[model samples]
Target: MPETNPQSRTGLAFGGDYNPEQWPEAVWSEDVRLMREAGVTMVSVGIFSWALLEPAPGVYEFGWLDRVLDLLHENGIRVDLGTPTVAPPAWFYREHPEALPVTADGTRHAFGSRGAICHSNTHYRAAAASITTRLATRYADHPALALWHVHNEYGVPVSACYCESCAAHFRRWLADAHGTVEALNEAWGTAFWGQHYTGFDQVDPPRATPTVGNPAQALDYRRFADATMRENFVAERDILHRLAPGVPVTTNFMTALSQCDSVDYWAWGREVDLVTNDHYLMTDGRRTHVNLAMAADLTRSVAGGAPWLLLEHSTSGVNWQPRNPAKAPGQMARNSLSHVARGSEGALFFQWRQSRRGAEKFHSSMLPHAGTDSRVWREVVELGSTIGALAPVAGTRTVADVAVLWDWHSWWAQNLQWRPSEDHDARERADTFYEALYDRHLTVDFAHPEGDLSAYPLVVVPALYLMTEAAADNLRRYVESGGTLLVSYFSGIVDEHDAVHEGP
Candidate 1:
C-alpha cells in the first residue's frame, strides 16, 4: 500500500529505520521535513514498540502509530511495518512470569533486555501470534505500508527457553524424530554409562555444566533450539500472510549470525517474499575492504543474490562496539558505496534520528546533536542526493559464480562440541571458505541449503559436520548435474544428530 512499489528494475531505496516513539509527537512533521531534505525514502517502524503498543495484556493502542504512519505517508516515504513482537510488554511478563530465558551460565534472565522470550512457550507463542495477526489485519490495507518486518533479529543473546515448556517441546521434538525413547537413546549414544532413558521426562537440555554427557544429545538439543526459533519466525510470518494479502513479509537478518542460521532461515524465507539483513561496520578492526566486501556480498547472497536491503547500519560511530569511533570524513559514503559495489540494492541505517536515552543514546544517526547543521547530516544529505541521482541501477544482480554455505543452526550445533579441533567452529571455517573463494577470483554468494543451488557453477560446503541426509542428497544431485561441489575438512562426519558417521 506504499506510494511507490519496489520498482523491480533497478535503483536502491535510500533511508533508515525511524523510531518516532523516541521523540515527542511534536517532532513528527519536522522528522518528515528533515527526511525529505536528507533524501530518505523508506522507514522501518514499530520495531521496538511492543511494550508501547500493548502496555497491558489484551489492550492495544494505535493512536501514536496512526499519526506516525500518516506523517511518513504525507512526506512520500514508504514504511516497512515491523510486527511489534520482539520485546513483549511488561504486563505480559508480569502475568505469565515464565517468559524469561535461562542463560548458558544457569541464570534465569530478568525482563530488562529485549528479545527475551522463549519461542516455544505456549503462552509466548499465543501472545506473539495475536499481536502479529492484529498488525497484519490493521495495516494490511494501509497505503503507506510497503513490507512487513517480522521481528528485529530472530535469535538475540537473551532469550532461549530452559523452562518446563521448552523441556516438554524438546522431548516432543525428539520423540517425533526418532519415534521412541529407545531409538533416541541410540542416536544420543546414551547406552554408554547406563544413561538410557525409559520415558520422555528423562531428557533434559544439555546443561552448560555437562556431567557424563552424550555429545550427540547436546548436539541434537542445539539443533532443536535453533529450529524452534526459526519455527517462531515462520509462525508469525504465516499469520501475517494469511491476514495481509500481497504485502511482502520479511525478517531483518544479521549476517554470519552464529546463533541462528540464515541458511536454515532461508527455508522460512521461501514462505515469505523478500529478505533483508543488518550490516553494522563498527571498529577499525573490521574496516577493511575484505570485511566490508564480504559483509555486502553475504547480504546479497543470503537472498540468493536477489538484491538485499542493507538494514541497520550506523551513519557514524556505534556506541555498542568496543571503543566506538566515528566514521571518518567520506567513510560513511565509502561504506554505503561498498554495499553497492558488492551487491546491495539498498542501504539503510539503524536510525534516522538520534535517541536521547537507553543503551543506544550515543549511537550515530542521520541527525546528530547539532541537529541538521552538522557534518553528519551534511554527509547524509549528500549521499541522499547521490542515490536519488542514481535511482535507475537498483535491482542489478551481482555476477557470482561461487556460493559459500553458511548455516546458523549448524554453527550452534558445532559449538555444542565438547572438545573441538582448533577450527571446529563452523563460522570461522566459513570465513576461511570465503577468503579462499575470494582469493580464487570467484564472486561468492552465501548459499542456504534450502536455496537454489542450480544457479551457481561452484559451491563450497564448509564444515558439513552435522550434514543432514537431505542436504547431502541435494549436494549429490547438484554435482551429478555438473555443478562444481567443494566439501571442506570436517565434512560428512555427522548427521543432524551430531552422531559420528561411518565414512563411505
Candidate 2:
C-alpha cells in the first residue's frame, strides 16, 4: 500500500547495481551499449560512493556522478540513486572517532569495513544528513532519478552498540516505552536476582554478566538495537521524502541474514515508500529457490501485497559463500520469475557487470568478466527478453490465502539465555510453517501480529515466544471471526517483557 508506481523506467524494469565509476571513462560508453543490448531498464547507483562523493569534510564531488547519470539517461536507462551514506568516508572516522560502533564486550569496531559507524552516533547522523541534503536537492528534478535506495543492509557487520551515547539513547527510548521506573521494574522483573534499577542510567547493555544476563534487559537491548537501526533508516528516508516528493524510496532487506535480526522489517516497512529485498542463492544448489520464494513472500507481505523491487541477487555463484556453485542452465530465470510470481515487479542482480578487481570480483554479474560471449551474459540478455514478454505482471500483484505471524520481538525474546530449548529458532520455525504451506501449493503472507489479518482464511503463527496483550486479543478476534489459526510447537510462552506467560 505504501508503494507508488515504480517511477520512470527505461525498458522492462530489468537491471541491477551499475558502477561505471569503477571503470575508465572510455568503458562507460561500452557499458551503455551493453545495457541497451540486454534491455536494461533501471540501475541502482552511488551506494558505495561516499569517499568519491565527499573527499573531505563539506567537500563534495558530483561532477563524476553527473556524467554517469547523463550517460545512463541518454541510453534510456533510469536510476535508483542511492544516498551514499552506507559507508562513511575514512575522513569521517578520523574527524569523529566516536562514530564507530562498540561491540558487546565494549570494544569499538575497526574502520575498514562498510558499516563501522554506530547507528546512534550523533556526529555520523549530522554528516549523513548533510550528504542527503546535497544529493536530494541537487538531483530532485533529474529525469533519471526514479527511486531512492537508502543505506545498504543495516546491522551488516555489527547490529547494536554498547557506547555511552547508545546507552543514553536506550534509556530515553525505555522511558518513552515504560513511563515510570516502578513500571519498568515490574515489567523487567527486576527482583529476579536483585538487579532492580533505581534509575534508567543504572542499566547497561547485556554485557558479560556474572552469568546469563537478565532476559528482560537483554530483550530491551535487542529492541534498542533494532530501534537504532530503524532510526538510521528513518533519518535518511525522511530527508529523501522531503526533497524528492514523488519518488518512491527503498532499502534492500535481507530476511534470512543473521546480522539483520536487529532490524525489525515489520516496523521498518512502514517507513519506506516501496518495499524491496536482496537475496542470494545459498550454498545449496538450485534448491535455493525455496528460500528465494520465502524472501519474496515475506517482502510481499511487508509491501502489503503491492509490488516490491527484487534489488539484488547473484547471476551465478557468490564469492562470499563457502561453496560458490553457479546455477545450472535455466535456474537463474526460474529463480527470477519465482520472485516475480510472488510480488517483485522488477528483476535485478547485485552488479550489472562483474567487478574486475576488489572483494566481489569473483561474484557473478549480469555481464560477466568473460564478456557477452559467456553463458552468464547470454542468459542476462535472454532474461531481459523474457521479462519484456511478461509486462502484464508488472501491474498485477501476488495474491495470498494464508498469513504467517512474524515478530522481531518474539525472535529476540526466544533467543534469550536459559530457554526451554536452545535449538528453537523463531525465524526458522516461521520458515518451516511457510514451507508447509508452500508444499501444499498455498500462497502465504508473513503478517505482523498487529498488521491486517482480515484478508486471510488461515493464519499460521510459529513459536511466538513473546506476545503483547493487544496481539493476543487480535489473534483471538481473528479466530472468532471464522479464521483458522494454526499454531506451531512453541507458542505464547512469554509476555512482551520476556516474562513467562501466566494463564488465567
lDDT of 1 at 392: 71
Q: Write the per-residue lDDT of candidate 1 for residues 1-504, one digit (tens) a residue.
A: 234553221367789989999888898889899899988888899998988887777788988998898778778788889988888888888888787777655667788778887777788889999999888878888778888888877765543567667888998998888999888888877878888999988898766654646777766776677678878888998898798778888888776443234235555446557778777763556325566677778767656667667777788888876688788899998888878767666678988888888878798988887797899999999998887876777777788878888765666567664646745877667777777777777788787765579988889888866677778888889999999988878776777667777766
TM per prediction:
0.90, 0.96
lDDT of candidate 1 at residue 39, scale 0 to 100: 80
Top-TM-score candidate index: 2
Q: lDDT per prediction? A: 0.77, 0.84
Candidate 2, residue 298: the lDDT equals: 84
Global CA lDDT of candidate 2, please? Answer: 0.84
Considering only N, C-alpha and C atoms within 3 Å, which residue pairs clash in candidate 2? none
Worst 10 residues of 1 by lDDT: 1-10
